[model samples]
Target: MRTADFHIEDARGDATVLKLTGDWTTMGLNQAAIRLGESLRGYSIEQVDLSELGRFDTAGALALVQASNFAMPANAFDTRPEAGRIYAMVETLERQSAEPPKRQAPLVRIFSKIGHGVHDAAAEILLSMAFLGRLMGATGFAFRHPGAIRWPAWVSQAERSGLDALPIIAVTNFFIGAVIAFLGADLLTQFGAGVFTVQLVAVAVLRELGVLITAILLAGRSSSSFAAEIGSMRMSQEVDAMQVMGVNPFQALVIPRLAAMVVMVPLLTFVGMVSGFLGGMLVVWSQLDYGPAFFIQRVSEDPDMGTHLMVGLVKAPVFAVVIAAIGCRQGMAVAGDVESLGRRVTAAVVQAIFAIIALDAVFALIFLELNL
Candidate 1:
């Protein structure tokens, strides 16, 4: 086959005419393409002549179109209708693809960004509410048909999220109690009321720190775990397969996690409370000369112990619900990618922790208003 070739003819008006020749097919086009660039450098072609062109194909059409900068007029290919059609198609596609998108004005861009943010936020809030409703509906289904409950999964999650978390929870609360005791003692001693440090530690841990710390710990550990587990199922499309099989993903995946958190959080909080008490009691007995007997006597005589402990325990179930809701909601939001899963998992932990703190503040306000 003849090799593809090109030569610049005399100038036409302000631009030159690039005449192509030879078998302008794929087999002969590679060298012609490179040479076409060098030969046409610093010369703008306003037209192309394909009359002598032989065996032209898409590759050759592309080379001619590029060498002429896609500016060839239709009449330039008077003797080669097929090559002209190919060149026209390539010219249209290349010119369209090579054009850049228009840039928006700065003010328009700012408003566009804000609008996108608001839209995304609204969509997210709606999705969260829809998932919450699904969870509640699943819960009602379980209540109406107890057999729908996944007892094995619930037990497994409880053991994992609860029993496995005990050591860290106990240790964290213990140090917290010890630090509170030290602060209370140091501050109270300045006012000649050092002995009351035991009461300070007792009330703080029992009323707030114990349950609060447990909730925060579970938010970090259990919330992320729940999101990751369900998000993986989502990524693998196991959740979709369950749906195809007429299985409720909410009851199967979400409820077990919610049940696990609901059942285990209170037990964990109770353990945390006891650990805190022990820590503070020991610190006071050793440093402030307050014996175990004196610590117990003060804690028992304070009528607020029962009320405060009840208040603290009451927050456990609500906090558990928040953690489970945030975790399960984020999990269900996973978009079938590693990046999506990671983002949802991180959002689960962050939103759970923030909700817990905000809810704790609300609880504190309600209790204060009620004089409890």
Candidate 2:
């Protein structure tokens, strides 16, 4: 193919005629485009003669239009319908591109983002409400048909989420308890109130840290697992297969995991509390020389610690439900792609953790109002 080139024809009494010639496809035009553009510089074209134009395309048309400073004559391609259409298309595109973009003010951009975020949040809340309704309906159905309940699945999830998670939960809460004791001892000792470290550990562990730690850990673990597991099933078409066979995917996949989570979280919280107490006791003994008997006795004297324990325990099932719901819903929303699965899994973990902390704050406010 001949490379695209143009020639300046002899002037016609104040008319500057530029004749475009040779193949004008991208392969040919791309090489000569710069040279042609430079050659046309400072020349005011009154007419463009395309009588010898060959192999026209968008790239060549664009090069010609740009080189002419976007002032191609209307009748330049009157003899060639093919090149005319291409040039016309390029003209429209170039004209649009030449227009400056409208930009918003800085404050407007900030408020615009805020408005969009609020709207998105409202939409997500509505979606969550609908999902919760469907989950409840599935739960009621499983309750009515006890035999349909996948007890094996529930037990399997219980082992994976509850039993398997225990060792880590215990170790984490234990260290947290020791840290609290260390901080308490460092502070209280200055005031000659180091003995109060026992109460500090009890109140902290039984009231908040134990449940919060367990919930957060599970949110990162079981919640992400649920999303990934169900997402994989959906991706592999197993979820669709279950639906086609008249088996409720929700009943088969979600409920058992939900039930397991609800039952197991409270138990885990309890274990975490005991582990925290033991850890704090060891710290107090080593630091303040307070014996385990004294630590236990001090904790026992505060019957209010029982109320705190109840407060923590009550949050466990709610946290569990939120985690399971977020995870399963994200999984169900996954598209048929690996990217979608990864995004959904990440969203599940983040949303579950956020929901847990926010719900805990709400609980604290409610308890404070009740003076509990």
Candidate 3:
């Protein structure tokens, strides 16, 4: 046949010829694909012929095969002798385009992950130790450079984190003491030991309730606030900007808050303890006909002031570190944007609270063992 234009006509019935002309390259193939797709949309395009195709290339061949694949029933065009080569090429393309099956990690790769886990654990431990060391170094530096202790910032944190939280601590501790007394009186009344309810309430409040309740309250109040404040500053790019301006984020942002909490939580705990004892005394006097003397005598007799003070005071420093660590970590980790900052702040608060509780348990176990 002479090299000329190609035409597709129906194989059966009154055939209408559709012309395919010009050099068949990528654009020609695209045009052919578009025309075939458009014609097939509204009409029942059952069959097409490319026998007159001239100057056809692989692109044109592929385009014809794609059109045939979509317009015809499966395996109907595959059986044609002229389409056998095109079908084979399409099969190879389909196979090559398919995603390869995934393989599970082998024993070696699994062991390698395990090894990395160990290294990560060790690195975390070292990081924690380094953090503590840095705190100690900062404390020492503050002692040496007393002027560097930003009094205004420290006072601001103390008033906000500790002084402002005072009313809440007092109120909660008072209710807790009242609840303890009421519960103890009811339980001891069966044995005609209602008078000794003061002793029980006093002992529990002084030894455990004071520190525990104060810590829980601070966890909810101060720690969360710290995290949110730090996260906000971080998200606002203030902390990074400080670093750019040659400011140590730790000293400028974190150390003052830590120092304030360390000094103030102990004071706050003492306030809570006093309020709790008074609340118990109130219940005892009203319900059990006992006096304030009874509560004072009972609590003071067994638990030394030094012991109570030492227990709460020691926890203050630890709680301070926990709050600062969580806040600073969350702040430094803040990605840009308000949503990420909010998430980090919430996570920091939750994690810090859980950590404080765990630390409190460990402290309780150790102190009980030490007879403190």
Candidate 4:
């Protein structure tokens, strides 16, 4: 039919004429199928005639076929040429709709995904172990990739992570130290041990707080930045581009970041130590008339100086690893979406900070038990 106005008289006992006049394509067929199905409902209509259907397409033919199937199984269906065309159209429409949608899965899909993840992770670990074994066999290769040093990478990283960070790290730590001195002064004054503020600032800054604070700050500044930068590169397909050009993304991106963090954290720790000491010196000299020399003397007098310095320095690389690992892992995990990249980078920063704090606490407890 040229128009949807064509219909059967007294059909379904409703005394309505089914009209059909449209494009008669997939979209049209869908509309016809829905309307026909609705009209058939709660009605005794057993068949339809479409002999006046002057034109029909594959979609119209399919819809007509489906109508016949539905009517036949439930009731006796009379077929006319025009009616047959309409029935065929509906049949095709139903078939097309019945096909599943892509990327649509069941409700428990996440569990299936998790199971696959566990399997993949296990397989990856096993493969890595096997590769390590092969490396062991290749003594020359292992020698070339020695665990002890990667001097060129280290120097490059030190320039980027440490040298570049110096000014900000120094300024921040100085303020932090000043704040601690002010607080320590007030607290110690109440105990008639005001002079001991020097010891409090010295030991706390060097032994724990200074390194931990510096690490946490860097984790925020550096780790999150690394994740975002790499994630953007990943989204733009630059990482894949590099791979296509025969460049190692890990060596080019990850190694540099990891090396930089490792080199910078120690130097930052040193900066923090100096600034914190200076901060405390300011408060002691200005408020208490203790003088810079007096505060320095108190630090020098501490017999545990070497132990405290060693503990702080040793924590640096651990902090660096946490920062770099979180950044790279999250960056590499990024999917194609901008939202996913932002979320992962934020998570990386938070995870890195938590890891740094957790590791610092563990090391502190361990060292305390060992009397370090």
Candidate 5:
């Protein structure tokens, strides 16, 4: 059969008529609709003669209805029952599209956003405190029953979070130390006290940068890994299985990680300190032509070495607790989806880093007050 087509009868006046002929099927309806719409655009369509249309499907009906701008009256077209029903459906859809959407006031929207953020922050803080409490309880229980401690898991985590991370940590601290030495030497040279560069590197690396860099690296490495691993377990229902089998997820999953961080972070901090010192030594020897023996002599003579080293190491355990807790807490918060796992892992790393920096600032204030 011939494809459906339409032609304008008289489109110049206020009342226009469209005469459709042949088979009005899907094959030709789209083009037919375009042509019909163009012809009817200049005038108000008053009549549609579909009596000559041989056969039409729902597709054709929709095309004609849309081309008429959903304003075609019921009596305007002599359409088959199927086409009439299709026309009615399109009309309903058009009415829905034309509806004006409801909008909120700008102030209301701003306040709603602020309220949601505050609520989310409060909820996150509460959840973190609850997780911290659980971890402390687990640690106490392990201490009471030494046999319950997962030594193998703890050892394994230590290797991953400590030994394996040494290279990058060393490289990072080394470069930072070198940069500090260079800056210090350049500034102090003007005052003819270039030797004080050793003092600057020693104080900064031993007291702050070493431990801070180590914690930040671990926050990125171990925290993200912990979140992803635990989230995967949750996704696979392994955590649920552990619960069903009477295994405490906290003891099995969280405790070993917490213990590993507590023990290894201090060791990593020490490594960072040594690496940074070596870096400073290299910079001093190469750039300032200072001897290693002289640099060591100056560093050892500094009264703040003992105090700064002690203060820096002291922060390691606390930083470890925050990093591990944030990681595992975010992991436990994961929902049952890959997207949720990814989001939780990202949030875990970000939160861990922020917490470490904030806690470091707090520690700095405490030490300053203590005059250490």
Candidate 6:
């Protein structure tokens, strides 16, 4: 077949003519279009002559149409019906491309995005609240009919979220307490009150650090576990199956996990407190040359032990509920995809930790007001 070729014929007025020749086919059409396009740049083409064209294909037709800027007048290709039809089609596309895109002001776009985010956040909060209400109602129902409670599931979750987690909690809190004691001893030594490190460690670990550490750890570990477990169940449609079988998913799936957290967090907190205290005692003994017996005596003599311990333990149940609720809520929100499952699981941990810290702050304010 003949190779495609085109040339701009010199014109006298504002209108120019592109004269195409040879076979207008895919082979060598792109190069022809490029050369023609560059040569025609300084001229405005209002017409095209395809009478010299021997043959034509879609690609070459499109290339010629593009090179002409789709401005070929209606009568320009009337002598060649094929060229006219192809030019008409490409002209429609060119007209469509000429339309401007609708755009919003930058400030308006920013506000629109902010409004969408706020709306989504509010919807999430309302959904979480609804989940919490459902869980609470299910819990009350279980309480009223103790036989309906899933004791086996609750025990298994306790083992997973509590007993199995003890070593990490204990080890973590121990080092934390030791660090605090070391710092307190160094600071207090400046005032010749290094002996008071015992009281400081005791009060800090028992009243705040111990429970907070346990709660944070559980938020990362157990909360994520809960989300993943329930999320998998959701993905596999097991939760829906439970509902179809007349089982209340909240009671069957969530209440047991919630009960596990409620029962175990305080216990873990107590263990963490003792572990941290022991760690502090070890640090005091080694760094300050203080005996364990003397340290124990100092801690026991602290009159605020009862109030501090009570204050710490009182927050455990609330923290447990919040963690469980966040975990289960995110699990229920999981869509039918692995990415969604992973995202919800991460959100569960983060939201639980945030809620724990915020609630702790509120509790602190309330206790401060009450002078507790």
TM-scores for candidates 1 onward, in order: 0.75, 0.81, 0.67, 0.63, 0.88, 0.83
Which segments of candidate 5 are over 4 A away from where they belong?
1-15, 20-44, 51-69, 75-79, 90-100, 103-107
Off by over 4 Å in 6: 1-42, 47-69, 73-103
- Model 2 clash pairs are none
Local error of candidate 5 at 307, Å? 0.4
Task: Tell me the deviation in Å of residue 15 in model 1.
Answer: 12
Predicted candidate 5 versus true structure: per-residue lDDT over 108-194, tens digit per residue: 999999999999999988988898888889889999998998889989999988899999999999998999999999899999999
TM-score of 2: 0.81
lDDT per model vs. reference: 0.89, 0.92, 0.72, 0.73, 0.89, 0.89
Error of 3 at 118 (Å): 9.7
Candidate 1 residues lying further than 4 Å off, grouped into runs, are: 1-94, 102-110
Candidate 3 Cα RMSD (Å): 9.7
For each predicted model, how many residue pairs clash, with residues at least 3 apart or on different chains?
0, 0, 0, 37, 0, 0
Alpha-carbon RMSD to native, per candidate: 5.5, 4.0, 9.7, 6.6, 3.1, 3.9
- Estimate, for each residue in 1-372, the C-alpha lDDT of model 4 and write its tens digit: 244333535655654434444545554454666566665555444444444444566665565455434443222123345544565556646757755656737756888888899997697457545533433344344346766345676687677667777777777777888888888889889999899888888888888878988888888888887888889999999999999998767666776677678777888999888988888789888877898877888889889887888898899988987787777777876889999998878988987898888898899899989989
In angstroms, give how far residue 71 of model 6 lies from its true place: 2.3
Per-residue lDDT over 279-347 for candidate 2, one digit per residue giving the tens place of the 0 to 100 score: 999999999999999999998888798799889999999999999999999999889999999999999
* Alpha carbon lDDT at 114, candidate 3: 93
- Best-fitting candidate, measured by lDDT? 2
Runs of candidate 4 exceeding 4 Å displacement: 1-143, 146-156
TM-score of 3: 0.67
lDDT of 1 by residue, 18-88 (tens): 78888988897869887887787787666777667789888887877776576566587777777778878
TM-score leader: 5
